[model samples]
Target: MSDQDSSSSSSSQTEEELDGEMDEETNGEVEKEESHRDSPAQSLSTFSSSLRAVIRIKQKYQVMKQRRQEMALALSGAGTFPGAPTRTSPKIFTFDGVTPSAFPMLSSSNPQKKKRRRRKRVLFPNRGTCRSPPKQERSRAKYCLYLLFAIVFVQVYNAIENLDDHVLRYDLEGLEKTLRREVFGQQGAVEGLLVHLKDYLSTYVHNKPLVVSLHGPSGVGKSHLGRLLAGHFRSVVGETLVLQYYVLHHCPQEADALQCAGDLSAIISEMVERAEEEEKIPLFIFDEAEHMQDEILDALWTLVASKQSNEYLNAIYLFLSNMGHAHITKHMLHNSSSTSMASGRHSALVKELTPVLRSSLEKLHQLWSEANILPLGLLEKGHVMECFLDEMTREGFYPDHSNIERLAGEIEYYPAVGGHEYSQTGCKQVVAKVNLL
Candidate 1:
């Protein structure tokens, strides 16, 4: 019985060992078959995937390249900016690692970049945006914009200041009234002055500057007219607008041309500076244009052409001269026939003399005339008496009717003998004798 139990146990143990070996062999066979089946498909799939990844990388590179080219063209026009950094090759990068400013097309205020930029800011505390490429462009553009604005403002100001004559309006009638009230004679001359000024007010005339030459014999109130002009304008505009220069006083016979020019330039520069404030033209009066040196005249010609001098001026230039008028001939006998003849003759003489200045101006090519010849004809006994009486009244010596007759008799009166003749003793002498009377 013991031998039988032992045999059974040995047989069972051998059978268990055999069963384990068979199970192991079957499992190995199954695994080998499965591996064999998967090998080719897996290898093929891996190759295809790698190819696709390479194609995608190339496509991304080409797209990035094109974008870079566009940005280069935009920022530098045709090429790269001088002294600025430029990239030569395309670089591969993940979205997380890409620089925010690497793409110029991106908006600066992108929300996604804010956290990354903030992190970078902490890491690079000394890196201010002033050295950034985009900001530099913006800074230059701002400067250009300011320069353009300034140029435009200057052009607009100049255009408005050089307005045309038709656009100008003033109390011309008021000026006429003022002249008529204060002055004794030369009604035609006064009217002519107004007409010229009207032309100057518009672009059609000498709008930048109008020079007026008052040609007449001495003591015909040429200087007086100038004073009246100064007074009239000073009252309305101000004292600064009018500049008076006596040709005899400022420019002596011995003074050189350069000296005269320097003196005039100083005056003109100062006048223009002051006139700029009011935006109105300034006035210049040359008391004796005839006595002005030839060199001074030439210098003036050059000066007038400069906008720096004439642009701010009133366009009114008055020159007083001893010569240039045709005196009235014949004595006033208080006879109607003689008076009529004398009046007719005087009218003819003035008519002829009016063109004389115009002709001279054309011949000399001188704007120096601002020319209009209005002869202050010889004052008749009546006119001189009127002037003398006016003077006496102003001096607190109101002469009665008989006193006036006696004063007239005491005054020597010389009349123009002919159209070509002039008064040897104009009212100039008559003025001195008034105090004696």
Candidate 2:
């Protein structure tokens, strides 16, 4: 009985020990499972912190790179490529209510779309082929610019021309009126002189001096016309540029011709030099040119010839001569008709008389060949009466028309065509007759 009781007790004790060991194993397994779950929470916290730190570092790196690129662009005049990296503030990431493992899934949600946008921003050109301006439009703009430049150039050119014309003013109209009013009865001579003067004075350049020869009988106003021209030129260009020389007064027949030529040449040289310096045209009138010796004419020819110096070429020379008076008087008495006295007939008269007058003067000097022969025609009886009236009025006396007619009728007249008579002495005695009045 003792042995049976002992055996039963041992079994119970052994079973109790085995049960305690099993409970210990179950508690250890439960503690391990709880520890494993708790470890996941701690690992998640650590992973989230590390992930935020990594993101912050990457954002810092991106910001630094953007700043570097911006600095480079600024240093290079800000003309960098459009897709070049630019500066931007870093975006702060919040992991609230989100697991660290879900970060990759969230970032990858629209990977294709992100990649397309990045490529478009980084590689695409700012201006596309379709957006570029057309070649035709560009050419039109260039053409418009050229046209505007051309218009400005043309306006400048015209302004310069107008200014030049104003500066070189020659009052031809005033000269014409003065000649027509003051110089009477020699209509052809006045017209020819004016035409030549107008053409020569219109421009500032000349190849040679203009030489005009006035040929007629004595007492036919040759000296009077020379005085008028000298006065006109003096008024226009001042006194220094006008030289009125008389053969008898300046170089007498008894004086040495060589010395007289030298004096005349010096005077002409001084006048021309002064005129050129002042940009002016000069006038020279030689009265009684027929009395000038060969030496004097030769000196004049040197000055007035085509081969003269540039400064000497810009002058007007008037030669008053009685060399062709005989021929001129004969031709006028033969052709003195009312028809021949008209302005239209003046050209025919010039054509007929130029050869004869030029031939007569050329016998004296070859210089006359180079001259423009202007013949002073014989005055009519009516012109003589008009002259008497003019002289009477000029000497401060009241002109009596009947007395003028009587004085003009007393002057000898040659027979003319159409019963019109011309005075033989063309107002030469009118001044003496007026002084007697």
Best by TM-score: 2
Candidate 2: regions farther than 4 A off: 1-170, 337-344
Q: State TM-scores per candidate.
A: 0.52, 0.63
C-alpha-based local distance difference test score of model 1: 0.61
Q: What's the CA error at residue 18 for candidate 2, in Å? A: 98
lDDT of 1 by residue, 287-342 (tens): 87777776667666666645644454455667777654432222222222444344
Clashes of 2: 0
What lDDT score is found at residue 279 in candidate 1? 61
Top lDDT prediction, candidate number: 2
Considering only N, C-alpha and C atoms within 3 Å, which residue pairs clash in candidate 1? 165-201, 165-202, 165-203, 209-315, 210-315, 212-317, 282-314, 329-416, 330-416
